[model samples]
Target: MMQTALQVLDREYLEARCSLVELGAAFDRVDRASDHEENAGEFNDSRLELLKQALGILTEESHLPNRAERLLLLFSDLD
Candidate 1:
């Protein structure tokens, strides 16, 4: 079956979003690691900042309100 341009774009966006979520989870894990507590403080903060920037860019490009909320809820869940 041939996919339309929009279908292809949507699939790509979904894949990218999933990848970003996975990346965030990995960072969250590191942030919670007691063994790396001291260094993780700086590292986790930088990763979180970068992830937020990436999420902001994705939301802007897609003009998706739900995506922004999803990102917000994601970080909120970690808290």
Candidate 2:
């Protein structure tokens, strides 16, 4: 169940990325028309940063169990 949830989250991450292009274009329009490039750029930058953080968390959560198992095996010889 947790794995399935992680897979869903991964899919969401991909979908979010696909939508970013269109959203960025809209931001560009605002940047051009209003001559507020910094505002638009900052908004897009913050969005991208948030997306990266979320994706990183999802990836780490998905792999954590496998990593733990591997660690256990790596130290098994010491027992």
- What are the lDDT scores of the predictions, listed in order? 0.69, 0.58
What count of clashes does model 2 give? 0
Output the lDDT of residue 4, model 2. 88
Per-residue accuracy of model 2 over 1-79 as CA lDDT, tens digit each: 2568778788788787877776678656755755665554444456555445544543465634575454445445564
TM-score of each: 0.41, 0.33
Candidate 1 on 1-79: residue-level lDDT in tens?
9999899888799887898889778767876784576654655455567576756755575655476666666556464
> What is model 2's C-alpha RMSD?
12.2
Clashes in each model (backbone N, CA, C under 3 Å)? Answer: 0, 0
Q: After superposition, how far is residue 11 of candidate 2 from its true place, in Å?
A: 2.1
